[model samples]
Target chain A: MPALPLDEAGKYVAGAYVVFVVLLAVYVAIMAAKLQRIERELRELARFAEQRNGERERERVTTDV
Target chain B: MYGKGLRTLSIATVAALAAALSLIFFYAPLDADQGFIQKIFYLHVPLSIVALLGFVAGGVYAILHLRSGERRWDAYSYVCIHLSVIFAVGVLITGSIWAKASWGHWWVWDEPTLVSFLIVFLLYATYYPFRYAIEDPERQARYASVFAVTAGAFVPLNFLAVRLAESLVHPRVFATTAGGLPGSMMLAFLVSIAAMALLWVTLVKLELTAKSASGQLKRLRRALDAPAPGAPSRVAPEV
Candidate 1:
């Protein structure tokens, strides 16, 4: 097979690399979304724990009084 | 635990990929036959090779899962296959592009290698629906391991059949005998393969860490006697 002219061959080569880069970027974006969900959940869990601690402290104080 | 050393691994992957790309463009000589179009070979072939190996690795992990009855092995198998499927997609698209550039068509049934790869891709594509169909988590994981092992065995056989199918049109680029690839091309190809392999590992680790974190969250919620927030994942088995 004869060598393809540089300009023509360049387009296809560039397209292939671009596809690869775009796929990686998309995967990174997905990981970011997952990280966000984890962060939100952790925050909620922390708040829940704090509220539970406060309830326990208030009940102890009332019992002592 | 999965996240440990992730930063270093990612940095190494980037460095290797940079080296591979530079070597591909600057170091490797233009092919006498295919010229600049041949540059696609470095990317396409390495990805195909790594993805195929990944499928087999998934199968191996599946075997371990089955032997030990451990869910972590199942998680490992699932992630390996999942990433490989993505890699396979890249392979097929890039392969098609290379084929079109070389053969003047988007697809051709005549090439056994291309057709066989397509068949393999199609078979793996059924995995998601198959897992989703079985609602029982234990049963689903077991069945999936069986599928992974069966499919893993199929990979090598498929490649052998394609290789033997008598097609002189597709150049065997890896023919490493007398009058085969020159040293520079071989070096660049090896570097590209290393880069792709590293990239695969880094992404797999990233995904496993995310899944692990999710699992930890569920454990914490159970300890706190809190309600589960989201609908359970149908396809991905939790560790």
Candidate 2:
């Protein structure tokens, strides 16, 4: 049943495999973006907390002085 | 063990998946009999097998969590089952395409591939609503564990039943798939299987990481929201 560019059957078969690979790539990209965002947020939170603690310590030292 | 090891494991899994997929497309020979269409079988079969494996892994861990009262085990189990369902849906679609190409029909009622996978999809469908219905988190996990274990048991039984049915009804035309595959093709199958397994692990880790991060973020935000006398950024919740 030879027909057209790659044979209808063959094209469909190849397409099936292609669909999976494409879906996988999309999934990885989503995960990567998510991971980056989460890490960035966590870092921001860490810095904020550290700065707050430092300010609190400074105030305590000033009162003692 | 798996709780803290996710990061390194995710990288290694991605590498393994890449290697396995390379072997699938590059090293595997074209089938002498089924031609290009048989190639789909390489992916479809492995994905189906791995989906079953995913459910079973979830079931096993669910049992552990229920017995030991470990939240980590419950989380792992839920993630496993969830990803497996997604992957299984992929397999079902691709397999239907393959079957249509080979048999001149979109689906076959008696096809072992069609029947068994249908059973699994239905079984997994029930899992979500069942999980959502329960109010107590641990108790919900406990019931879900039981259902997942039951589904895990049925998956193999359905597979076996389909095989037996094929033998009795369509003995000549529906012989086992193993007879058709050659050595190179077999290698491809094995590689595909490995790749799918690695992909499953990688995907699960990524999802779990996202969930854990969000959970931690929620806690951090709550703590930040509390009236810390020196904190400056309590104006609004972090977007």
Candidate 3:
């Protein structure tokens, strides 16, 4: 849909540049979401480990008392 | 702490991305030749360069791991290669769009730019299998590192070969903005690069975390599956 003589080449180039920005922005957003999800999962795992550790500590105190 | 690398990389990347966008949008001169489509050049070219750099990082880390016998180096190597792969995909997609407008094709084998990208893609595709083939962690890391190191050298060589084997139908990269582009445009371009690099590091860190978590999970499972300290004598007798 672009005409010749390189007059509109500038327009085409501009279009390409715009597309790049949009793509990059989208990519960053997706990565951010993925990172957030992974962090959430890690938090859950850490909590599980902490709970197990707490239970063991309680058992030790009961025996000592 | 994400450490200096992550922190600097993250901040720099975000900032660069912001700057790059602004430059391209507002400051950079409209191409004298390619016109509007030329704008894609700012994004497309930088991506290829970044992807190439990513592979180089992987390959270098791989060599270091092999020489030193450090398992951690292998982790870094794998991460670098992974980042390179992601960037490579970006290059291909953006390049294809650029090609369609310029050369009127979604795909072309002979274009040096396209050819370089494809070879890089193929090179990286094999990396994952190399990663997963061996069951032993140390062994897997050792062999994979060697492959990564070797692959890094070959990517450049392959790129050079493409140039030699066929004429570059596409425009020479970075030529447009190389000659005294306006200040704002320069800033935007730099910002984009920084943003991209940061984001790449973030992904690498994420992958590294996943790798470590999986390893720990395995250890936990092993501990659970192990037999109890005492014998089965907890039961009175075999009925």
Candidate that would win on TM-score: 1
DockQ of each: 0.78, 0.44, 0.24
The reply for model 2, stretches above 4 Å from the true place, is A1-6, B1-27, B167-180, B216-239
Query: Per-residue lDDT of B16-35 in model 2, one digit per residue for the tens?
Result: 66766676668887555556
Candidate 3 local Cα displacement, residue B124, angstroms? 0.7
Q: What does the lDDT read for residue B79 in candidate 1? A: 90
> Per the 3 Å backbone cut-off, how many clashing residue pairs does candidate 3 have?
25
Report the candidate with higher DockQ, 2 versus 3.
2
Worst window of 10 by summed lDDT in candidate 1 chain B: B170-179
Q: Please write out the lDDT profile of model 1 over residues B188-228, one tens digit for every residue.
A: 99999999999999998999999999889988999999877
Name the best candidate (by lDDT).
1
Top model number, DockQ: 1
lDDT of each: 0.91, 0.73, 0.68
Candidate 2 — which pairs collide?
A: none
| Ranking of all predicted structures according to TM-score, beginning with the best and ending with the worst | 1, 2, 3
Q: How do these models rank on DockQ, best leading?
A: 1, 2, 3
**Tens digit per residue, CA lDDT, model 2, A1-65:** 22223387667777787778776777779878867876877777788888889999999999999
| Per-residue lDDT of model 3, residues B1-239, tens digit only | 22336666667666767777777768877666555666676777677777888898999988888888876677778877877787787788777877777678878876676776787799799888766777677777877877887889988888778656646467654443455545655566666666676667776775666555544544553554532222221110000
Give me the displacement of residue B188 in model 1, in angstroms: 0.4
